[model samples]
Target: MRIEISVESPQGVRAAAAAGTARVELCAGLSDGGLTPSVGLIEAAAELIEVHVLVRPRPGDFAYARDELDVIVRDIETARKHGATGVVVGALTTEGEVHDACAAFVEAAGDLATTFHRAIDVSADSRRALDRLAELGFTRVLTSGRRRSALAGAPLIRELAGRTAVDVMACGGVRAANAAEVAEVTGVRDLHAAPRRPVGSALTGDVSYAGVGVPAGSDHFETDPVEVEALCGIFRH
Candidate 1:
């Protein structure tokens, strides 16, 4: 089994490396479900660990316009240029099918490994979408079996794991507490998560830069290395 951690900052990347994760899914704005990280961040992360850059231009739905697709392609190129080992991406059609524009992303990625992001969860049919993504030559697909968390979707995840030629990386709300059960039930070897804890800022005041859902005084979140090690320990036995 391999553990993959989602990380937004250099410290998070270092924590993943220190904990010996298989790779780190490098991104920015993880609170918004992860947008593309800066080129500098990508470069810095690549130096410490195997970095798989998430090529999302913005948050929200996976359906993208031509210009947005173009930007995503460029971002893939940027990830490769900066020493990324892989790229995580996905695009869906307005009709809730896999978008044809995804081919451009793979082409731009060149020799890098590719993972279809959780966009498959919102597709018209998760099984059909996985098949199409496999045909498109996606190396893997990150999914929670169309559910909010992998544990909640174990049955569908197990079914999808059996049905696909492409690797099924179980993600979404995965944690040390449920990691072993998720792996056992879903029969998946790869688990992905951003194990984070809030760290208060030194600049304390009534003022706030926190977004919605974030508490007024919270500074930011940091990936917990202890949590990463605990999750990794589950598979060691």
Candidate 2:
């Protein structure tokens, strides 16, 4: 029932730690679903927080090309070098199965704790993917329980947790009101939640979507300490 918070930037990491969050998944540009953080962010967060830092690589999509996977591989190496305690990544094949390429990364990470990211939902078979991750020695997999939202996904999350040795980390749509139910059903020790809204892209691409902002009613992903406290408060009892 420990609360793990994801920080999309260096400031988010500092704020999460100050709020007493248990861990920070250090990444960037979460509006596009997170990317590898800069070395400065990782190092600065490590210095400030007692909580573990889980680094993620890549900006979009789990199914990556060779060059992109190389970026991820290199990021893992760099993250470890700069004090990240763990790394998070996952990949799916063209057929929607766990990509075998990830197995090499499971080896390359070399003892920095690793979790297969939410690509679990994209896999055609969650059962097979979880089993493969355990075999590959991934410490965990972030999932929304194979449903659109964690609330609806709780059943499958619990099922997966009961069936596997690999840690099942529930995320997406997990909020203060729902943490206990998720933990109670899934029997998971770790939880990942981002109680913040998006800011802006550190950099932009040619791709454009009109009327698309941070997806927050507000303008930015400032840390919401109250949200963090409320979710942690739910598990306090």
Candidate 3:
């Protein structure tokens, strides 16, 4: 019955804090699937609220180049300094294995809890990825059940939870209408959502948002309050 919302803007975080949510995933450039937020915003959000903040490194794809990896590592350090409670990250090997020490990433995460992000989804094999993450000591794994949306992938997600020691968190296309069903189908207690008002993308960054894929028409990529409230209603049901 826990709720988590991803917020890219300070305004969104304030709204999420006002909504009385348990945790908030803080980042920026959500128009591109969540780029690293400024240190100021991170610190400011941390100071004003009690919600746990999970920071994302880049807004790009799950496959990170060496430089991007460095950026991710540096971003994590900044996020931690600014009071992030945890972090979300994922890196895939060519064969789709989790890059090196799943434990090392966990360790790199320091005291904050770590949740390997959707990079696990693009892997060649989900089960092997699950085992590696579990072995590496990740607190949770965010997945869409290996399908585009969580609902479609629920079965695989559920199987994953059953097969691995790591916690499985259902994500993608999670909304009020089917949040509970996805949870039920996936047997996943944790969930992640990026619900934003149907606003148009700003496109100010002049960077490519192609890989992130904005759903139809939406301005922001962070979780939307309207959606969260509705989903909460169902989850409570």
Candidate 4:
């Protein structure tokens, strides 16, 4: 089984490489699900390991405006220029179907591998959407079976793995504890994990980055190397 780890920082990418992950989904703001990482981050990550840059322009719904899509395309090109092995992207229509504009997204990828992100989970019909992605020439689709976690959605994930020609990469809420069950139940060839370890913020005084009445804290999460190593052990054994 191929183990892909999502890393938001260059440090995370290095940890994934040391842990022997098959690939890294390079992005920023894991708190926002994921957004396109900077070109420098992509370049640095690609040097450490095979990197698949996320091309999301924003955090909200996947239904993108023309300007937002233009940004996504530009980010895709940037990722390619940085030697990304693949690009992760998705678009949806207002009615929650796969967007027709995905053609441009795929084209922007040129010869690089393209993996449709979990925007399919919010689609009207995930099975039908998977078929649509396959027709669009997607090399893979990352989904958690339209559920909160892969273990909870294993049945549907398994079905999609059997039904789709595109690779079904099980993702979302995957951790070391449930990795084996998810792999066995879904029969997937790839698994994606982003296990985090919370670290304290060094800012001590009245410094607050959170504006607009939001509570202020510098505490943040980063990929945990121990978690990555433990998860990788499942495939090794």
Please provide, for model 2 over 76-131, each residue's C-alpha lDDT reduced to its tens digit, 9 standing for 90 to 100.
88888888778888778888888888887777788878888888988888989999
Candidate 3's residue-wise lDDT over 100-171, tens digit each? 744545666798878887788888899998898887888788889778899888888988989877888888
Please give, for residues 1-237, the per-residue lDDT of candidate 4 as tens digits.
999999999779988998889999998988888888888898889888999999998889999999998888888888888899899999999999999888887898999999999999999999999999988989999999999999988999999998868999999788888888889999999999898776655777765464222234536777899999989887786
The 10 consecutive residues of candidate 2 with the worst lDDT sum are 203-212
TM-score for all models, in order of appearance? 0.95, 0.87, 0.83, 0.93
Minimum summed lDDT over a 10-residue window in model 1 is located at 207-216
RMSD of each: 1.5, 4.5, 4.5, 2.4
As a TM-score, model 3 comes out at 0.83
Model 4: colliding residue pairs: none
lDDT of each: 0.91, 0.76, 0.73, 0.89
> Candidate 1 lDDT, tens digit per residue, 1-237?
989999999999998998889999999998899999999999999999999999999999999989999999999998999999999999999999999998888899999999999999999999999999888889889999888999998899999898968999999789999998899999998999889987766675665655435555667788988898888878776
Model 2 clash tally, residue pairs: 2
Looking at model 3, residue 54 earns an lDDT score of: 46
